[model samples]
Target: MIMDIIKQGGRARTTGRPRDACPYPADSRERRAWFEGYDGSAWELSTRVPHPSVALRGVSACPDAATVSNQAAAAT
Candidate 1:
């Protein structure tokens, strides 16, 4: 979605992450989107904001039912 592109790009720019460090596959539209925000003001933002990462994102998608059950069983 457009919002996702904006978000990733913004993060890339703010974090001063290299263009090659895009999480999306090579030659993909998402990578292009990421590059959008990663222009011009990268170092400025990077000085004020941390780089992007899953841990820094703070939230995560839920696992599937089977995976959850497996984890629960393993715990018990």
Candidate 2:
């Protein structure tokens, strides 16, 4: 398997080995500036992309059960 080189500080996913080669999220809200793992892990294997701002906005706009449930599901 190909190794994923994650930034120790910033949360960007890059294809190349160079640290600065990752493409950042275009949306300001989705953009992350830092990431941390205690055990000196190289990468976080994930299948989903983060959409925190959307989830936050959704929850804020409608704190109802249905929207919150949907957001929770999406996050997972």
The number of the candidate with the highest TM-score is 1
| Top lDDT prediction, candidate number | 1
Estimate the TM-score of every prediction.
0.40, 0.19
lDDT of 1 by residue, 1-76 (tens): 9457757777766677776776878777666666655542233344433334543685333448668889999999
What's the lDDT of the predicted structure labeled candidate 1? 0.61
lDDT of 1 at 55: 32
What are the per-model numbers of colliding residue pairs?
Answer: 0, 0
Stretches of candidate 2 exceeding 4 Å from the true structure: 1-5, 8-46, 59-76
| Model 2: per-residue Cα lDDT over 5-56, one tens digit each | 2233233322223444334454332123222211223234443333454455
lDDT of each: 0.61, 0.38
Kindly report which residue pairs in candidate 2 clash with one another.
Answer: none
Q: Give the range of the ten consecutive residues with the poorest summed lDDT in model 1.
A: 40-49
